[model samples]
Target: MSEKPISKGKRSVVITGASRGIGRALAHLHAAHGFDVLAVARNFKDFPHHPNITCLPLDLTWSDAIPKIIGCLNATARPFERLINNAGIQVELDLTRDVGDETPALIDREIALNLTLPIHLSHAMVPLMARPGGTIVNVTSLTSRQPKSSAPVYSATKAGLASFTSALRHQLAPLGIRVVEAVPPLVDTDMTLGRGSGKLSAEAMAQAIYDGIAAQRRIIAPGLSRPVLLLNRLLPELVAKILAKS
Candidate 1:
């Protein structure tokens, strides 16, 4: 990815789940490019950041804090031109016919964190994106297209974002607010440590992500993720079998 050009004219950017993984990489990349970064996460204090980065300790899962946090971001001279909604969880929701549970607790939790929180954040940020060059980069997963048996709810949430990315691209295009999906393959993060194979380094994934954003590629995937997406399109059932084996 081309180094985020200083000409991009970004004064500030907001990235969630910035304690580690891809979120942290993007934060550093933005800081290096002279963009003030607002990093939000549960353990944000643990992450070291550049002078330009402001760490906001926020639990996005706490539904009530959304408006207040967004207000703080908006009360600035320059609102965020880039918004990366990467705060999501990989939850295990094993709902089966024989299962006896009072409620679909796992499914509800996944929807809240993985889907609802991001949606709420985006809704709050849309008004701040009054400028002509705003961007929204959602860090989704490869499992959106290759859902396996172990984490159906996780995949479903990502798949929803994938679809939202497409529709949002059209909706926001006229307004100049580009919505892109950073669909990563297995990366060397705690989220995918035991779940993925042939993982790419976080730095490499970060580079690809920024490149895709600068170039405005709607679906961003590094390493072999693009090929895998293509293969799944051509041979979905075959790809399912392979993913099931994994």
Candidate 2:
């Protein structure tokens, strides 16, 4: 039998960190897929005035502004059936910066963006999205599966997100909302600029997220992320050691 097609109708999605990189790519891709989107970023200047998209610029690390932004969107008209937590920044590249020096800031920032923001935002949108056929895709990292010594904090943040996604899926599955983890390998984006030995194209990662949403796949790992997940499952210690050396 042929599979049922994805029910498309102005996908009605909310994607964070939409100014550039994977987040920006996702916004464009979703629009191309006929989604009416609310794209949030650090500032509106980085976003374009697309007919299908509404740009909401605010630093999510603050955490206090999320409800207000959601309220604004709701006041205008709720056009979000899916919430893509795709916004993130990398502070670990400056790894040698040291703990007492700036590690606290890095740790705090990662938790805010990678963990707290998404969790709070998800909670806010649950009633709106957890009804039926609703979806959520969290943009995670290959480092979650393969711990890189160079980016210790980034890996921790991704790992936390991975765990959160699974737990969220379990909690919201019965409610009909699909919480998915879009695990991406290294991508050629500003965040990964000048970093990551080999890079997966942003388009590739975007397609993976789209496919995951279409299929309601709980975990979508593209390119090296897939292999990394496998190794993490089969030989975690070996993978950890290998990653440390890389």
Candidate 3:
């Protein structure tokens, strides 16, 4: 669906998964900077109330909800300066194990949230984005660079998003929209509770993303993700062996 032209006024940002973790941090950062924020999440009972923030409670997994989201944005008449696609889910079940009844449903949900939603939202917002300074940030993961054994579907979805972001970047460059890929390592969010060590805090990761966007970095790899990416590039086999052991 095409969004109507937004009126020129206060810069606005739309962030998915804004109820917690990195998404919450990004919403606060933008709001603090005086930008109006459209924070989309399933629940906002604990979200900080802010004058510049509008909470939109919605489930992103429902493909039919995309049009309603865009319609809401159009009705707001706020010029879009940024769109952060940060909502995602990971099922940590090993595919080789005894399959459960819910495995297929979980896989579909993961793919929809991690990959399809972002692509659809971006497509809908491209025409409404600010011509000269708009930005779209896709929050990918280190797993995209090197897949994990337990969450193969999550890893594949992230890798697909990375590629989509790359292509979208080139396609949108002529119109001056910046497409940014944010690759973060294990983060200390509820999503990764008790999963990995040496994880970066959500606040720290958000700061890195903000700084990287300000600097117009095409790819933002914060904390351990940076070294992990470099190692994967320089010594593929060594990285593969290490990941295999993990």
Candidate 4:
């Protein structure tokens, strides 16, 4: 479903996983900053309303998801200036565990949602993006640099996305479309609850992402992720060990 946008003159941003957490914060932040926001999520029944925010309730893993999104944008006839691929899922499981009954489905869902959907969505959205200065922001994780033992699949997906973001950046340069990797630290979102300490708020991360885009930063490693990435470079083993325990 799509909500009618309140205004048309403002620059537009399309954000996935926008019903809650960082995605929700991003939707509100961009709308507040005078951008018409297309907020995509599976459900928006609980999402806060905003005149500039148009809600698109969609299951990203569906085969027809990309087409539906394209249709929604086509209805607008306006190119989006930014696209943020932030929808993801993390299903923690031990690969060595004897839970075949659930392992395969869980792994497949995690991989599909965390990696495949974003890749496909980004490719599909490129044509709809504003040329000469469009930005595509892929939200990554610190776990990409140092895998979390309990969330192996999630970590792997983030790492794969990071690599894709870098390669896409070079490929899109001629088109004047910038691809960015936003590596946020452990955030105080539902996904990270009961998992980490000193978590950054979703609002803070949302602001940082906006600032990074404005500054044309290809890699935005905000909060603790900045120092952790530096430390990881100097002491990879140490960083890995620490993350393995998280």
Best by TM-score: 4
Off by over 4 Å in 4: 6-8
Best of the two (2, 3) by TM-score: 3
Q: What does candidate 2 score on TM?
A: 0.88
Task: Report the Cα lDDT for candidate 4.
Answer: 0.88
**Any idea what lDDT model 1 has?**
0.78
- Count of backbone collisions in candidate 3: 0
Q: Which sections of candidate 3 miss by over 4 Å?
A: 1-8
* Cα distance off (Å), candidate 4, residue 111: 1.0
Better of 1 and 3 by TM-score: 3
Per-residue lDDT of model 1, residues 28-94, tens digit only: 9888888878777788645764777777777777766587567667555454688888877886656
The lDDT per prediction is 0.78, 0.78, 0.87, 0.88
* Cα lDDT for residue 175, candidate 4: 94
Residue pairs with clashing backbones, model 1:
1-211
What CA RMSD would candidate 2 show? Answer: 5.8
Question: Please, what are the lDDT tens digits per residue for candidate 3 over residues 1-246?
Answer: 112333348888989998999999888888888878888889898887777788888899986668877988878865589999999888886888838898899889999999999999999999889888999999998788888778899999999999999999999999999999999888999999988788888889888988999999999998878888899999988987888886
lDDT of 4 by residue, 15-111 (tens): 9999999999999999998888999989899887788899989898888988998888877746779999999888787888837887887888888
RMSD of each: 4.5, 5.8, 3.4, 1.5
TM agreement with the true structure for every prediction? 0.89, 0.88, 0.93, 0.95
Measured by TM-score, how close is model 4 to the native structure?
A: 0.95
Better of 2 and 3 by lDDT: 3
